[model samples]
Target: MNRRLYRGLREAILEGAIAADTRLPASRDLAAELGIARNTVVHVYSQLLAEGYTRSRQGNGTFVNASLPDSFLSSGRRARLAAAPQPRPALSPRGAAIVDGASASPYQWGAFMPGVPDLTEFPHRKFGRIVSALWRNPPPDLLTYAHGGGLPALREALAQHLALTRSIDCDPEQIIITEGSHQAIDLASRILGDPGEVAWVEDPGYWGARTVLQANGLRIRHLPVDEEGMQVPQEAGGEPPRFIFVTPSHQYPLGPVMSLARRRQLLAVARRHGSWIIEDDYDSEFRFSGRPIASLLGLEPDAPVIYMGTFSKTLYPGLRVGYLVLPRPLVAAFQAAHAELYREGHQMTHAALAAFIADGHYAAHIRRMRMLYGRRRAMLVNLIERRLGADWLHRDASLAGLHLVLTLPPDMDDLRVVEEARARGVLTRPLSRYYADPALRRPGLLLGFACVPEQDIARKFEVLLDSLAEVARKPARAARA
Candidate 1:
């Protein structure tokens, strides 16, 4: 009863129904009028007075406040403020560019949404047990800001694991734990290269890398990716790029493994120009075909490469754990820079992850997902090949990773196709969005297979096909009309 009375008065005051300085009826009078108990009315009146909606006089009845508090501003007040001229919020040139060219989708998970792994198949029980045990009696160090790069246990586990799996033999001290691959890229971009220095980025590369580099004021020079991966020219005709960014294991969007010859040539060219290569080993775990290859960083004893890898695909992304394997010469500096720039933490999560890896749960989970993803990938490829023909598929579509690029004819717009598919309750990304240069943008769709179930993949792909058919008919129907 008091709650109802309180709410009614509050609404009346906010809506301007009860004008300023209007006297509120006395508790006894209002209670009698409303056929309610006097105590309830008194309680409601007292609340309003305490809340600044009303003011009490020593001998007189309560009156509405002349000015409402800022915190008390209601929909009526908000509407008035909206009618006034508001200044645009200021942002720097780099900030403006980042916001304007943002490529992130609001929809993160669903059928054909690229770069996502199946969360349904994750080994949550094993991970949860480890995390729950840690929280029962957490150490003081786990709660504080992480110093000296990251958790020692996690780094040690990662060092051993990377050595055995990827042939990246390094001391635990050389590994710097990061929030994700995005942060790792940001740290490398800011620490390794300076503003205005040229950065050779792959055309149709990861947009996150481009955003971070651009934010750091590095001038990007797009290098075309081929079947053999990023082509390294015989000579640098003009100013040489200070940093060379490549996805060596499996090229993004296009999905080409860098040929060994091209890899050696790139290393030699980079050394000649005094350039550093930033190798992003993204989605390298779930290679669908053949034996998994060794990392580019492990090829030489002291390669001038900053290697980055993430557990986002292998583990769930919400874990927010990634690592940078630095060369011995860079170990100390990068460790210091990471601590200063990011102020890393999450030692508890790091501890849990370390235990998870050490106990072989991580390995077992990856193996299981790899087989599951391979099956889903096969089904998706079959559907696309049967409906659209094998010619429409990207050459390296089946080699590695979660997504495959379905190439479109030159006249068709990939963005329009994406929109049409999105309208049909399906999410897919346009491959053209990955390229920095508008002219170099190719028409293709990056459809993810790992996230979608085998049964659901066909259903979603059917809806996706209707989108393509509708988009294809658009030009022909317009011509006749």
Candidate 2:
């Protein structure tokens, strides 16, 4: 990277390709365009400065020197390195797998685009006021690396909140704050699992969880879900999995609450196998109807479960706050491991969040959003049921979460529909990509209603319907023969 940048820049100056005193792009801007680090560009600029190829003003930016000698064109070693043929960059197999397995969407904000909450509804003014107050006279500890897993106040506040809302009873000491649920998953995978150990993830499950586990070298085992939720084996056949990642409250993509019997079964099997049940209770809040289900961790005392929760869905993704509630025995291990790996310290944000929760702002906000999302979800369902038909909606898919699965005909191509829909301005995710087993992939779309406005919902639905119109009219069992 340096050789290319350095050579091209100096050659341009020496050949008078770039006129004298021409200001170059800012380091950050150049770095962004080149997809490289800003520091890398700065390093290149420094070299040019040292070689009298460029000059810099205090605040103006780097500029081509007004006068540079002609002798610099024959600058010995650099000429050879720059002229040498450069091979394509290579990545480790694990690194390439992580990229191939990635399912995150860059276009997260739009109608029917899944997994993003409506950030516009967040109490930015109130939350900002609290955050601003902290920075007025920020404490020194807030800026330093924190050895503590998290600020005690925030952990305690979360502990109380979970106990009341989700029926998860855990001490504040069991909580480990992380940047987000992904980081929490990574930490859990690293601490609880060894390479090549199995991690049983739900089929058509949350891809992010699987990607993180796979990156950590755990072989993935896809377990199918049904009306009763994940179907774990009766016993650990041979070797038990080191990790079992699940969303028992409301299964992702496909919706079904893990039945009481299944929950009991999972607990017993995990215990027998000495497996760690990683419960990702993400978006447990905003249940559209009835009381939310109790967490898997609470079903049995001393259940080897690590409860992972996040503020991304409840609050906003940019908040960068998620936590893990470990079993009593795992507190020390996770706390130490998290601090060592992530260096979890966000004193000001933690303090502000604790205050927000303690003072009831957090609860109050959820109450409002719960009602808001309920209306939107109902509206989307009504529109679909009226125009398309009830058959299209997954009747068993949980009524909770920011998105719901819209089932398509077996002959329909969900990936093609998604692409066409996106081109027509209706963003959605193809259900086919969520499955680890290619054979198990279903034809469906995950339509997110949480982020879309109520007035715009119908308009967006019409656009999406147009995209599906092509396959909607075709025969389901047409044969090429």
Candidate 3:
């Protein structure tokens, strides 16, 4: 009898017939109605409360548990009801747009996939040892919420390293450690620009940066990029933008080091317009050519440039550690904003990274990977020229960075070719998809050679080349028909 009563009540709750928080009848009234003793009703109600199906208030009557799990209430009948499909709630306009424009690949690591480091080569044993030691004897401060702009030890180490290598003139105080360059960009966009304000981004630029700016409600103005990097607008036709995004060190996808004259000209434009420059120095450490180009921040010490760098390319992406070097005046505001917004904390990892840099392991690892990647880059270029033929596709003369852009015929659909190539197990990003304005986009493929093994490069290129060759033949075949 109790089993029958319990099952019925549970089914009602799970099926939404008896909505959450609905009070059950008094024990006397229920007992009389069901033709059962009052004690029987009390026992059943007590059992329901114990099993978390319902709750009881001392003064008031018993009620159904608002937070009861579906599994707890589900019976033979309720199980069938649970399987019924329900309509999903509508997403906001911005949310829907973000979902529609999603470009992240399902698979991260493979041949020709860009911006991924060789994780197998990472010194995990050394890092693990450091982590183990720190965990065994953890400091009070290390376990607490991080404040006042990242770990001091890591900041100091980074300051020394950046000064020595990138020629960035900044103290530890001016550096704000973040989860990655993505967060650094988000923080900068929020603090620097307001909703509906103008922001300038390179036409065929990093899509990630463009997405961040757009998500912050900033109106993105697509500026064309040439061999000298982003072309600074000479004449002020309209109102100045709040900020300008650039990858000057090694221009993303289509790698072009911004010339000294162009850098000065860009600075002049920014100064005249009173717009801040967001310089993303991602993957600058992997330069295989002449002397490394100094950062724009270093060129003009007092320039309004927020320089960002991430260890994702150099170390591993999972580290989720990156830094932003801001001017002295903007440091406090950024620090406060970072704290209020992100509240980032990875003290142990930061300490380990600091020790790794200070002990020379970080620099040593970079030197090893640089040599490995250089060979890989040359092999890929050689294969493209030899197997694919230079007449059909022109490889961008990029002396640095992990990826190279191969320009296709103006009439070709790079996106369609990329989709077909993915079917053949060769991953490549279509260059046209990176542009904010589709009308201004050029047909090209961004091939990443850094993560691919030396031996696998030949085989992978064969697959990619075949797909591209087939694609090239399509238009000709159509014309002949």
Ranking by TM-score: 1, 2, 3
lDDT to native, each model:
0.89, 0.89, 0.87
lDDT of 1 at 87: 82
User: Whose TM-score is greatest here?
Assistant: 1
lDDT of 3 by residue, 40-126 (tens): 888889888898889889989999987776665556557768787878879987777777888777877888988888888888888
Model 2: residues >4 Å from true position, as ranges?
1-85, 471-481
Predicted structure 3, TM vs. truth: 0.83
Give candidate 1 misplaced runs (Cα > 4 Å).
1-50, 54-83, 476-481
Write one digit per residue (lDDT tens) for candidate 1, span 228-286: 88978878768898889999888987998998999989888888999999999988898
lDDT (Cα, tens digit) per residue for candidate 2, span 96-162: 8877767888887899988889999999999999999999999998888887689999999999999
Residue 423 of model 3: what lDDT? 92
In the order shown, the candidates' Cα RMSDs to the true structure are 3.6, 9.0, 7.5
